[model samples]
Target: MISKRPVHVHEAVPHGDEPPGCTSRVSVEVGGRVWLLDREADMEALWERMGEDDLGADERLPYWAEVWPASVLLGRHILRNAEVLCGRMCLDLGCGLGLTGIIASHVGARVVAFDYEWPAVRFARHNAALNNVPQPLWTLMDWREPAVRAHGFDFVWGGDVLYEKRFFDPLIRLFRHVLAPGGKIWIGEPVRTVSRPVWELVRREGFTAELLTVEKVALCGQNATVNLWEVTIS
Candidate 1:
């Protein structure tokens, strides 16, 4: 995995719960390395007790669970198979905490990491520093819009970003737009049977798709099943 880079820490928020809620911490492992994050607290409080708590923005998100299957696969694949990433230009999309991008950077890929949520974006940047990876280009972006500023990435990655069927189309559209021809798009998602249509669409769009070996992913210390998606861009 990438070496930890120096973090540009933001001013810490007041140490108390506010309007929506407080912040919790989650440690996402990419490859064998782990990153600690102070994230916006969820109503369930799954990650709140992991460590010290801090307050931050609490905008409702579609998927706010502590453990994610997709991220595990992305991390494992790149870490266990470093040759897939040597010297590649990569994008880590919907990069909650930036684990996948961090792993890519560690393996010598030049990476750009992005997420829409400020808290997640902040954590992503911090994780890059925490893991001692090369400083990745970071950005606040809505993948649904035209990403005119970023182009020609050899690889694009996302994990567990397909929970809502409504967002799948636009997400796939953005993947098609950002990846260089002959590049790769890898996504890790749990077996949400509803995602079959999106998989079919990816295949129809001329990208080759395959499922990786399913594995038990650790989240907040518990185990969960995760599936991997490897998309070969034409």
Candidate 2:
């Protein structure tokens, strides 16, 4: 569980632009259970557009915690299709909020969730404790680092990580280095055209792929074009 701190220690951004903060929340149903998240900070980031300031590296803030729709879709599909995650050693890369890892642990898998963003790591840990999920090993490791050149895992998981072009090549190379022989990787992507190259690259790496459809309806809204990919490394 997360330890409580004094309210004066941290200045929280108001939920909305009003005098009274609006309640920001998201709920997803996964593996026959519902997960509820209340994140005013994420809502503030949404209103800020995540790229508004200097709109570049200088403007980027630490701990920007927005939950993506793809995470919800893919986490559910992985739990459904994979025979048994129980007792498996899993690595969740770019594990925003650690939803997928939490679900994996819920099913008896040991999970290591990594995120480059420090804020994401903090929230992931808090969310895990809040949901009664196993407290996963959390690290602030970048996939492109040479230090991770030899790290590999039985199952690698990620959700909605293909949003930027800069990280694409590094992400693929990281997966190639870390995935064990005959291991599986799962990704959930929206119908973004840029994501096609990622799929092509995965196939070129000698993995067999198939797409699974997921129905995701969060309190924020409904996402219909969510598709989950199950790729098995040969």
Candidate 3:
């Protein structure tokens, strides 16, 4: 019964062009409960802005501004399996809009969520308040040089983080460094050609993975299936 609906405008103020930092609020229903989230109002505008900007190697566009289907699928899975995560240490990587972390907190998991950009972390904090969940430790973090402790987490998860080929090896190293003994990892992803070699790569690194579930998701007039995989050290 997950649904996405537009926010009603109580006071409409007309403007020619949307300004920077302009945002929209959305309601996402998961596990029979509605959660509120905020995102950038104009995706194309942000992309255009990024095009004109001077950027470093690590900095990228505002891909975190939109709620992707993988996040929804992971959120749904967390809400449904709340009991298993209760009191467990969980980390949400690239926690865009903080939906999965908030849902995990609601179900009583100690959550630590991080994003590459500060805006995404800010939005996650705000969304946690909106959803009435205990705020997780939301931090601005670059996964390439993470400032986290070794073997610190029990369950580390991410949604749609496998978009870039360069990140594959770094991500696997991060997983190995941070995951505690007997800990697990879950990744939710859409059907993508670039992601086809992921399992083979992980298996080569001595990790085992299995498809846990597939969820059909609709976003912005498109329908697709999101796959969730449970991975662990072999």
Candidate 4:
């Protein structure tokens, strides 16, 4: 079941040195526009806390709470093509810190940002507020849910969501279900072995697929290449 309730981080007596909701401010520049994002200050500490709190496998790791390089590239791409977003209804699938949806909202698109993790949804909301962008509808939802399929999105954006081969089929099914007529899906993925088969499946599904751009991005102090792909049903 999908929950629309927003989670708040309350300060309780800490089991360790750092309490929950510890965050740092990060400024990102995309196409001459700047967005300020708030992220967990220490991911390792957060992970430990998650373990203490007995979060499940998906929630135990705070991977969704950090800003990823692919997200940065996707934000840049959205800002570069801002005009296309005006008056569009967009979806940010598995939005981590909500950078892509925030950029889409900044560019005048009506956006719905979704993540399966409640903490991630909270952080995404906080990031939107931090940047002074209009808050998109933040929902804690799994991609395979019937609620997710109910929305007709004109453009669906995701970053670094193609890393696991196990999720490819579900992701593709969700994309096909949510996309409106004449809609497009934009994905920014780091070059990985799993990405090839996913792309091939997308092609076999009769979508017109193309590699829109490839650029080097700095991730965790290391340079990596990110490829942006555009897909539409033919």
Candidate 5:
């Protein structure tokens, strides 16, 4: 059972005149269960921030700030298979608002959620508190960093993370480094041009990739199709 705890207040971005994007609450339903999450109300402000100061590779993408459709589908998958995760150590990579990790924790997994953006980590922590699930350890660190490479996880999960071709090598390396023996990876992505090559690479690396499900989701007021894949090292 989830416990209700006092909400810890973190210093949020100032909303002066401009709308505060993180003020709204979104209710996400997965496997007949509802998880309440705090979401950024305005994406334009976040995009503007990303554009400022000649953004670099890691800093240019503000995609982590929004809850994507893939995350929702991934959360449902986790809930549906909660029994398999009991007592396992799970890693929610690029956790954004932390829905995946929170759901895993609720179902008995020991979860650790990490995101490259500081605001993402903060919001993830807050959302975990809101849902009253055991809060996963939240960290603000890039995947390329050596510190993250040292850790091992029984399960690695990500949502909508394979959109960019440039991220493929780094992600593959991270998967190889952190995945424990007999570990599995769960990914949810919208079918995009860049994803096919990544899957080819996964196959070449000796992992058996299987399509688990296809879900049609509403994203930014439009319907989008997302695919969930399960990969295990052969």
Candidate 6:
């Protein structure tokens, strides 16, 4: 179990009312160290909240509630190549739970992390403070219509962000606008059929895309192969 959330969290809900929601704290191991992360305790309930709150079409589901293996893979890779991240200006694009950004900040990088969903940003900020590391400047921003320009990031990275084709253009726009000259974008995702076209799209956009590594990780109650894709301006 990759730090499984407890089946039942906190005190019970009273009779004839909505089930109480909670922030489930799980201890996660990243780069040979234990860090505490707080996540929404019930995902299905969170999805219902998304619908009730009108959280936009992009957030059709509460994908940010769990600690994805892709994020864990990125965290480990950052430790393995700490030299590349140290003192670098990095952006944790679409950062959920802020694991990658937190680790980057821990290893001495100046990081800016953002998520479209406010709940995700809230928990990421909480987790960073819980870990007692240097906090990232968390922003609630939409990639499609960014309120502020994220200029000059040496590295722009995200985990499991290539699942949808609709975001390919905006992602490229971010890379072109925010990434510094000779900057790199690393995205981590489990091998899924839907993600196959993203590689071709990367080349079509004139960026050099390569398989940085294939990390074998346990994800969603199964063993999965996570492809760490690195893209850069050609």
Q: List runs of model 5 lying over 4 Å from the truth.
A: 1-22, 49-51, 57-59, 146-151
What TM-score, to 2 decimals, does candidate 2 have? Answer: 0.76
lDDT of 5 by residue, 203-230 (tens): 8987888999998976557787999998
Each candidate's number of clashing pairs is 10, 2, 0, 0, 2, 0
Better of 2 and 6 by TM-score: 6
**Clashing pairs in model 1, backbone N/Cα/C closer than 3 A:** 2-106, 3-131, 3-132, 3-133, 4-131, 4-132, 4-133, 5-129, 5-132, 70-188
lDDT values, one for every candidate: 0.64, 0.62, 0.76, 0.73, 0.73, 0.73
For model 3, what is the alpha-carbon lDDT of residue 140? 64
Candidate 4 lDDT for residue 73 = 90
TM-score, model 6 to reference: 0.85
- Which lDDT tens digits does candidate 1 get at residues 148-187? 3445888887877766677677876877788887787887
Worst ten in a row by lDDT for model 4: 1-10
User: Per the 3 Å backbone cut-off, how many clashing residue pairs does candidate 1 have?
Assistant: 10
Model 4 RMSD in Å is 6.2
Alpha carbon lDDT at 78, candidate 1: 78
Candidate 6's displacement at residue 220, Å, is 5.9
lDDT of 3 by residue, 162-222 (tens): 8777778888998998898999998989888887788889999999989999889776577
| Cα lDDT for residue 205, candidate 4 | 82
Winner by TM-score between candidate 6 and candidate 1: 6
- The C-alpha TM-scores of every prediction are 0.75, 0.76, 0.87, 0.85, 0.84, 0.85
Residue lDDT tens for model 4, 94-200: 77777888989999999988776666767777777778888788766766562654448899888888777766887788788889999989998888887888888
Summarize candidate 2's per-residue lDDT along 1-234 as a digit string, tens digits: 011010112222122212123245556677678875544466355446565663344233433355666777767766774557777778877666667777777777877777665455556666676689777776556566623325457788777667566556777777778877778777777677877777777788777778856555353565546667877866
Best by lDDT: 3
